[model samples]
Structures are given as C-alpha cells and as structure tokens.
Target: MSILANPLYRPLFEILRSARNGIVYGGKLRFSHALVINLLYKSGPLLPRMKSVFEATKDHAQVLASFAIIYKIAVHFLQSDAVLGRKNLRLTKFLAGCFGSWIVYSGHFNLFNGGITHQITLYCFSRVLLALGKILLDKYLVCFQPSFINYQGDTMLYKNLNGHQQRKLKNLIYNKSWKYFAIITWGLVMFVYDYKPQYLQSSLRHSMTYIYDVEMDTWDTWREFLGI
Candidate 1:
C-alpha cells in the first residue's frame, strides 16, 4: 500500500487509471452512436453489422485510452524538470495535450481508414477551440462574458448600466449569440453544400446529399414511406 501510494509512483498510477476510464467511456459512447447511425444508414448481414460496430468501438476506445496515457506521461515529464526555468500551467497542459494529440493524429491508435479517429479529433479540437475563445473573451472582452459567470471588475462605464440593460446585453452576447450563429451556420452550410459539396466532409456531404438533393418530385419516396 505504501509503495503504491508513494509520490514516486503516483504518475504511473494516474496514467493507468486514466487509460481504464477512457476505454470504458469512449467505447460506450461510440458503441451507442455507431449502432444508431448504422441502423439509420445501412442494413446487411449480421457479421458486417457487428463488425462495423466492434471496429468503431475499438478505434474510439483505443484512441481515448492511448491519449489518456500519453497525456499523463507528457504532463508529468514537463512537471518533472523545469528545464525552461519558469513554468506556465496553461503551457504545460496545452503542450501535453498537443503532444498526445499529435501522436494520435500521426496514425498511432487508429487501425482502419481513420475516418472515425479524424472525426473524433476534429470534434474535440472544435470544442477546445471554442472554450479557449471563451476564455480569451472573458479575459479581454470581459463585458461579453456569459451572464451566469461572475467576476470582479468595476470599469467606469460598467457601473452605469442598470440591471435590466446589463441582463439584455449579456443575453445578446451569451445566449442569443449562439442562436444566431446556428442560424447563420445552417444557411452557410446549405449554400456551400449546393455549390462546393466536395469541400464538405464525406459523412456530412453524403448525409446532406441524401437529405437535400434526393428527388422529392418522385412518388417513389412517398411510396416507400407508405409501404407501397
């Protein structure tokens, strides 16, 4: 117990534990998603159906687990020797993440065509990019920070706004901003899909093509729906 609990071994313990958690979490999440999407998009022999699900599950779980292990190792390595003489917490975390991500992106964990790994990485990148943007907004564009987040500051003009006006501005920046962003995004994506669908990811392009470009003038679709 003492040896396992020793600080010297803490990093190893953390890496193992994180890897286990990542495998369980990533497998479950991808299994549910792949099952539902396959049911909607494809139907065939039981072997292929099970194979696709199992392969996707393995790829997602492996990527997550490997990333967890790599990140822990990288972070600990950085924290070990302050080779730079001065350390930044944000730098340590960001660099460690980048290290782990690069190893994964270099085709280490994924063994298939890698579309799933690419999508997963892109999803995480977009989310981290958004959160980083919000952090910057809070730091510099402090007034645009979400209403729900509280902080201290009393810049001169900030003191002049009444509660109602403050709430309104916060709503514009925090809440309605996303609503409009989505509206604009859908409009833009549809426009792009019409003219430059090749620029879209294959998954998105195929889905959009099926949804938007399929012949609606046909009674065939209606017949299928009606089981005719």
Candidate 2:
C-alpha cells in the first residue's frame, strides 16, 4: 500500500506536500528578495543583474526546500511508537531540529557571499525561539511562589491559595507577558545595534543605521520632508 494509505505513515503525504510547497514558495520569495536587493545596491546592466538574481534564487530556494523536506521527515521518524499521533515531543523536536538543520543547512547559499543563508537561519532562530517560548508557557508553566508544608510533608499551597487568586495571577500573566516581551525584545535589539552591530545581519545593521544614525538636520526641501 502507498505510505499515505497506511495509518503508520499518514504524514508522508504532508511531508511531500511541504517539499513541493517549499520549492514554489521559497523560489518566489528568494527571487523577489534577490531582485529587490540587486535593484537597491547593484550597479550593473539589467541582464547581468537579472542573471545574478536568478542564480541567488536557485541556491536559496534549494536550501529552503531541502530544509523543509528534511525537517518534516525527521520530526515524523523521531516520534516514538508509545506516543505516536500526538504532538511532537520536545526532546524529539530538539534532536530533529539540530540534526536536520545540520544535514540540510550545513552549506550556505551562494548569494551575497552566502549572506542569504545567514539571514534565513537567523530569522528561523528568532521564530523558533518565540515558538518554543509559547510552547513552554503552555506546557511547562510553574508558579514561582514557594510551597509551604504542614508538620507532615504535604504542600499547603492548595489550601492556602484560593481559586480567585489563582485566576487573577494567571490572568495577569496572560495579559501582560506579551507587553514585557515586546519591550525587552526591542531593548535587546537596540542594544545590539548600538554596540555589537556586527552580531546583526548586514541588512538589519544597515537598516538600523539608516533609521538611527542619520543626522536630524534641517529639512532642505518639501521633497525631503515628504520622502519623495
């Protein structure tokens, strides 16, 4: 029977589908990205610039498509039979992410001296960090309040804590976590951009400089004011 027809391998179809979609989507996105960057910074004949963009699209798209296929396969293959058909285990996901990334992204794309690969991986790293944070919030949450015990070794937390206080604290966290996270994220990026800009991607560093380092001189013209 086909892998899709078997219950044990129903996700094979999704893996294949992901691969196909990755090629198409990554190609389009990489092509646009390369083309835009070339238009902005490259000084060359149109034909040569288009040729360069095409070459970049090929390498970047290949890297993205390969990672998509490999990660999907790794996630499925690493699943244990005892917990099959459930959300992927964190340990399995960690192993699969590391191993698959090692296999598929071991080499860099040939765009801008492989800067495209750096950009992709850095973006993925940020996204994966946020995703894992969300997962931890959902599955591994803990109360920082110290547990009190009676003469016997039993947690008095439940007895001391009422449901309203529990709900209030949970509500406070749920409502305000994102606010603090956003502020801290911005602060960290600015800190890096200020003193350790070499740690940032070239495009990001350049963009930050444009935004933050440009002189606030008197406006010379209406065109300048209007950003024409």
Candidate 3:
C-alpha cells in the first residue's frame, strides 16, 4: 500500500509534509531577504561573504537573478503535492538534508559572516516553531471538530478519545505556544543585531563576538594561533 494510504504511515506523512512546507517557505523568505540586502545595501559589512560574491564576480547581478529564479522553482517543486511521488519525496528529503548541512557548514566557515549565521540560526528555529504550530493547529483547531472526525477515514481514531482526553491533548498543545513566542522574539533580536551590532551593550557584544568568532573575526588569527 502507498504510504499515505496506510493508516500506520499517514501521520508520518503529514508531519513530513508540514516540515517540508515550513522549510521551503523559510528558505524562500531567507533568499528573498538576501536578494534585497544584496541589491539595496550591497550586502554591507554585516555579510562579508555575500559582499565578496558580489565584488568578485563581473556578472554578480545576473548570478543573483538566476538564484532568485532557482529559489522560486524550488518553492514550487516543494509545494506541489500532485507531482511528488514517494521516490521523489524521498529524494527531495535527502536533498533538503544535504542543503541544510551545507548551510551549517557555510555558517561555521564564515562563508557569509555573522549575519548569515544569525539568519541561519533564526531560520532553523523558526522552521521548527512553524512545524509544531502546524501540528498543534491540526490537532486542536482542525481535528477537534465533530465534522472533521466524521469526515476522517478512521472513526476509531477519534472515537477512542473521551472529552477529557481531548481537552488534555488541547491543553498540552496550547501550552507549547510559549516556545513559538520565544523563537519569534529571539529571531527579532537576531535581526536587530545583524542590522546594528553596535546597539548591543559592550558585554553582550563581547559575548556574541566570542560565540561567533569564526564568522565575526578573521580566520587567519585562528590559524596563526593554531600554528597551521
């Protein structure tokens, strides 16, 4: 049987679908934000690697334009449920994982600088928040309705749960909203730091500098210290 057709695998499929959608949406937003920074501020000093890419290439504008097109194509591909079969789904998941790994590696290597690091961190945290929000929304807001239970294929799924059990589930999901709020607040703080690092207090700036040493400082110093 198809994965979605099997009751045992349906929940997994739903979770994967939600996660993929969140990632694609988050990535698209990040790319668009980068495009704006590249065009308007020229990546500024905050994102040194992006500035280097623009400076080192003669056709950097064309390259960025191509990247925008590619981002749109990726978003479309990820969103299209009708065209994605099981094999395609697995392949896409593998590709997404590889892309995520590359993003982490690039941040560590200072490929884009501290701003990129901040953006990557926030993007990841936000995606997780979004996935959890989707799950909770489906369970509490969508699935709790009598109409939803009636229309669902397996009546036993909801039939086994009493009112108290359903209320408990809703309460559990509702209580997790604080996590989503925290992620959003953290993302905003990162955004401010990316735009105006000097606005941060001296101690906080020092701590952030230490934390993002690879991205915020020169790699040559680290190499010299290591005697490489």
Model 3 / residue 136 / CA error / Å: 6.1
TM-scores of the candidates are: 0.79, 0.62, 0.30
Winner on TM-score between 1 and 3 is 1
* Candidate 3 least-lDDT 10 residues: 58-67
Q: What is the C-alpha RMSD of each candidate to the true structure, in Å?
A: 5.1, 6.9, 16.1
**Model 2: lDDT of residue 145:** 53
Q: Best-fitting candidate, measured by TM-score?
A: 1
Report the lDDT tens digits of candidate 3 across residue range 1-228.
Answer: 875699977655555555555446545655565556456544346567565444433232322233334443444456467656445766665555545444443444444334444544455677787677768676655456542243345454443667875666556656677666778877876786778989865445656665664654454587775646
Of 1 and 3, the candidate ahead on lDDT is: 1
Determine which window of 10 residues in candidate 1 has minimal summed lDDT.
145-154
- List the candidate 2 regions with Cα displacement exceeding 4 Å: 1-16, 40-44, 72-94, 106-114, 140-175, 216-220, 224-227
Q: Which of candidates 2 and 3 is the stronger one according to TM-score?
A: 2
**Over 4 Å off, model 1:** 82-86, 106-113, 141-156, 159-169, 220-223, 226-228
Best by lDDT: 1
Relative to the true structure, candidate 1 reaches a TM of: 0.79
Per-residue alpha-carbon lDDT of candidate 2 for residues 71-93, written as tens digits (9 for 90 to 100) = 88888877857644346578777
In order, the Cα lDDT scores of the candidates are 0.75, 0.73, 0.54
